[model samples]
Target: MSATTSARSARLGLRATPEQETVLRRAAEVAHKSLTDFVLDAACRAAEQTLLDQRLFMVSGSQYQALLEMMDRPESENPGLTDLFSRRPAWAKE
Candidate 1:
């Protein structure tokens, strides 16, 4: 379901130090959002970034050159892959 249309039925509980709570409260006030909203938004954003980081990587110049060389190589014949690609996808079939 789309974010705006989805019902928020889950409950979460967390503890924070007084100083942290004060800061979060002030920031939430400045952002014009409830404390729950501010925390949830920040947590979701951080979770997204963490997941994305898992799929992304940085390589040094030598590693990059190796990757480029691999891409430059000619495609090898793979009968299994070729067969898979030649068939109509299940969803596309009547």
Candidate 2:
């Protein structure tokens, strides 16, 4: 974790059955991590995987071709996009 991420201030509470707690504690010991660290790391990994699963997709060959064709198409004029791009981004220094 980065310095910013290391300063965690939120709290999460959970309950597990005795069997589940024992298994988790054993796994934490085997990994040489504190119980909280082990659970947080495992949970973060799981959360990342879950989010990636939602955003990523498999495309058929024809569908992929369609996507490529769309990308290769020329852009149309748009007043909104032109106006939007005219200004500098907020994060950019003058």
lDDT of 2: 0.89
The collision pairs in model 2 are none
Cα lDDT tens digits, model 1, 1-94, are 1133267878889999999999999999999988888888898999989998999998999999999999999999999999999999989957
TM agreement with the true structure for every prediction: 0.61, 0.58
Give the true-structure RMSD of model 2. 7.8
TM-score of 2: 0.58
Candidate 1, lDDT over the whole model = 0.88
Full-model lDDT for every candidate: 0.88, 0.89
Best by TM-score: 1
| The best candidate in terms of lDDT | 2
What is the number of backbone collisions in each predicted candidate, taken in the order shown? 0, 0
